[model samples]
Structure formats: C-alpha cells, structure tokens
Target: MGSLDLEVTVYSRHSSNYHSYKGNIGTVNDNILNQKFNAKEPYTVIHTDIAQVKLSNGQWGYVSAVIDEANQEIIGTVVSS
Candidate 1:
C-alpha cells in the first residue's frame, strides 16, 4: 500500500527556551506516509522564509519556527515584531 497521506491540522507554541515540541499537521501527515512506505520515520527540516519581511503591512517582523528532523523535535523559534 502507498504511504498514508495526511496533513497537520494544529500546532502549539511554547515559551522561549522551552524544551518541548508538539507535532503539527505536516509532521502527522509525514508519519502516516512513513508507515505506509515502511521507510524511516519522517522528520522536520529547517524552514527558510520565502516571503519578505516587508511583505507585512506596518509590521517590522514575523513569527517563524525551526523544527528538528530527529525525534520530531522543535529546536528554536522566533517571532518578529
């Protein structure tokens, strides 16, 4: 059978320096797919912002997350303002 195709529906953010991570829609989807394919568990890769900071109206910054692929861990996240 083909890998399970799913999507992350929700996610949560912890305070700065917090050492915990709850998987989101994307992670969940990958998991299903991994099982179906019987491949190594999936993990999250670092994300690079595609949109420019100036894209926001009147906003000087943005919020972004950095996820670790191993163990599905969240490494660091920053919210720009």
Candidate 2:
C-alpha cells in the first residue's frame, strides 16, 4: 500500500466544542418500555425513530419511520428535506 502511494480513509474524532454547543437539545421521556422489546400483538408495542441523512446533492434530510414490534415490519415512513 505505501509503495503504491495509497492511503486509507480516516475519520476524525468529534470536537469537544461541538458537544458543548449541542448541550441538551431534546426532552427526556420516561422509559415506558422497560427494556422489553418483544410484543405479543401488533400496534401494542410500535416503535418510531427519526434519522438525519446526507443526500447526494450535498443537502441534509430526515427520515422518520414507525415499526411494528410484533411483526418486525416497517409500517410507515416519511422523508423530509
């Protein structure tokens, strides 16, 4: 690798200043699930989450999805720019 002048891509560590500026951004909800992820029926234990993604055009977007715990299936999804 060194002989061919090739180098591996490396990711830098997150800056402490970034975290300090972030502070507490969201509200903390109660732990109603109690670490029990399994559900006996559909809709009884559905989980939802949102994720930020970088698009090909150098823009950011968000993807929100809801999953059924019992069936382990994605029931709903929404994408926003």
Candidate 3:
C-alpha cells in the first residue's frame, strides 16, 4: 500500500504566523503547498458539531481535527499514514 502525508499551515498578505494559512492551490498536475495559522472565520462552507473527517491530499494522507469552536484552537489532530 502507498502512504501519504498531510500538513496544515497559515498565510496572509502580511506575516500572520499566528493564525492564517498560506499555500498554493495546486493546478493541473502541479503541487499544493499550504501553511496554517490562527484565524477566525465568520463564514464557512460547512460546520459540524464534532470532527467528521480530516483534510487530505487526495492520496493516502488525511488530517482531522478536534477543535474548540469558541477559540478556534485544535484540541486534537490525527494524520493518516
């Protein structure tokens, strides 16, 4: 079986290392590099009461989080191999 890797990062127009994600949205056959930082999102495409599934690179990698919606801090995280 093949293995995959995953990561979370933050980025912004400024140096927001505290809470933002900075990465390249992959193009056709290209790669996507992302950076994660502290951020507050008033709007989201989806919201769940609990951690459902982690984000993945479409390979073997997956990232799930147990987050504190009040603070937006991740209480727990799991990365698949």
Candidate 4:
C-alpha cells in the first residue's frame, strides 16, 4: 500500500506581509506495481493528472489519477461528477 496525500494552500496578499494557509484535503493509496511513490524520486518518476470525460448521462466528469512511472500503471483513481 502507498500514500497520496492531497493538500490545499491559500495565499492572501491583502495582509501586511503575506499570509498562507494550508489544509489537508485527503489521502490516496498509490501503490502500483508494488512500488511506492515518493517526492524524493527522480524526475519523470511518479506522475499525476486529471482527465475530463463525458458521462454516459450527458454530464461532465473529472477523473484524477496517479500513475507509476516504472510500469506506467495507474495506482489510484478518483472520479467526480
């Protein structure tokens, strides 16, 4: 099993200097092909992207996924309508 944590950061310029706030959105398991994803890995190592698709019911959908570079396998997936 692997871990893919999602975070959202807010930056406010109206403040005196600059204020930033970070919040945890959620986590995803990205263990694919028996490999764990880590930031310390080399470039082109682990990749993630969002794909938009048309639902069968004539609606728009967004699919987010994490891919493992070693085997080019999608480890985790999330879909939203």
Best by TM-score: 2
Instruction: Using lDDT, rank the candidates from best to worst.
Output: 2, 4, 1, 3
Q: In candidate 1, what residue range of length 10 has the lowest lDDT sum?
A: 47-56
Error (Å) of candidate 2 at residue 69 is: 0.4
Q: Over the stretch 1-81, how does candidate 2's per-residue lDDT look in tens digits?
A: 999998543343422333335678899899989989999899989989988666667565789999999999999999999
After superposition, the stretches of candidate 3 with alpha carbons farther than 4 Å from their true spots are 1-59
Candidate 2: residue 32 Cα off by (Å): 3.5
How accurate locally, in lDDT, is each candidate?
Answer: 0.44, 0.80, 0.43, 0.63
Q: TM-score: which is higher, 3 or 4?
A: 4
Summarize candidate 1's per-residue lDDT along 1-81 as a digit string, tens digits: 136776432332322463435555353334434434222444533333322243336434565666545454556667656
Which lDDT tens digits does candidate 4 get at residues 1-81? Answer: 135564332332222442344576578676563565443443457678986565668565889998876667778899999
- TM-score of candidate 3 against the unseen true structure: 0.28
Q: Which is the winner by lDDT between candidate 3 and candidate 4?
A: 4
Our tally of clashes for model 2 stands at 0
TM-score computed on alpha carbons, candidate 2: 0.61
Instruction: Please list the residue runs of candidate 4 whose C-alpha ends up more than 4 Å from where it truly belongs after superposition.
Output: 1-44
lDDT of 4: 0.63
